[model samples]
Target: MWIFRNKSFKSAYISIIISTLIFASLYALSNFNKIGLSFYDSTSSSLPTKPKIQEKSEWLTNFVDPLIGIKNGEVFPGPCLPFGVVKVGIDTNDAGYTVDEAVTGISRM
Candidate 1:
């Protein structure tokens, strides 16, 4: 097979195939209810509903910013949506490694 011709390519191809298969299986399993597989019986027909949003508190705010320290200050302290692809935050330092006096402009992570 073409995969056998190059050892590195073969390994990469196999890894890609395995990862794809794993992702596909997980995706199918997650959507089993919507796909009509019906893993459970009539008794479990009702799915759990989303939790109600409440007023934000100090405890909740500190939870996300768990990281601390000067070197570890790279952590973003801005609002970010759950499972968001782009992380919008401030870049404290520039390429020169000097910290900016003010947190200016949104940086995409």
Candidate 2:
């Protein structure tokens, strides 16, 4: 009890009380896992914007198949003459909950 009369003891006691109060306040708050108590979130206002293009549908004329290295495919039956367009299957990654490079269907090439 006599040691409490010292100014250092008084300072240490005050520090302990302040620390306990801080701990109690933090424990009472739900967001104590995060640092610096904030009443409101700054990032709650805005959301991310979507991309411009949604689907990939393009027409290619005189298209040559790169795999076979020959323009032997047909538009409907016989070999499509030069400077002719054809529909080719390709992948689209615009707006959908699907795997990347997932081919939807064939379109005009």
Candidate 3:
């Protein structure tokens, strides 16, 4: 056969054929129970309902300020959106930017 023409290809073809047969047999065996049972309900007959769209009151973006704590001696007050990764701010101190300290350079975190 063409399968046995090449030594490497022969083993690969045999393995593929054996695996395919094994998987096919397993699939057939798995579906045998469902086939035997006449009243088997695999899925619901009713159609799926659509989800309702909820209307939110308002967004709290007004309350959020990216440069809120820049003047205070706290964390980095870099401007970034909610759940945002990239932030742009003034590099001042080791901890973060302060009001008293002069602007050294810009940084991203």
User: Each candidate's lDDT (Cα)?
Assistant: 0.66, 0.56, 0.71
Give me the displacement of residue 79 in model 2, in angstroms: 40
Q: Cα lDDT of model 1 overall? A: 0.66
**Residue 40 lDDT in model 3?**
45
Better of 2 and 3 by lDDT: 3
Tens-digit lDDT string for candidate 2 (1-109): 3467689879989899999999888787966547777766757766556777534454353364544422333223223446666534443454322333566754544
Off by over 4 Å in 1: 43-109
Best by TM-score: 1
RMSD of model 2, in Å?
Answer: 16.7
- Sequence-dependent TM-score of model 2: 0.28
Candidate 2 segments whose C-alpha is farther than 4 A from its true place:
1-4, 31-109
Per-model root-mean-square deviation over C-alphas: 16.7, 16.7, 11.1
Instruction: Report the lDDT tens digits of candidate 3 across residue range 3-97.
Output: 36689988888899999999999998788878775334658666566886554545566567766655664655557766757777777656665
Separate clash counts for every candidate? 0, 2, 0
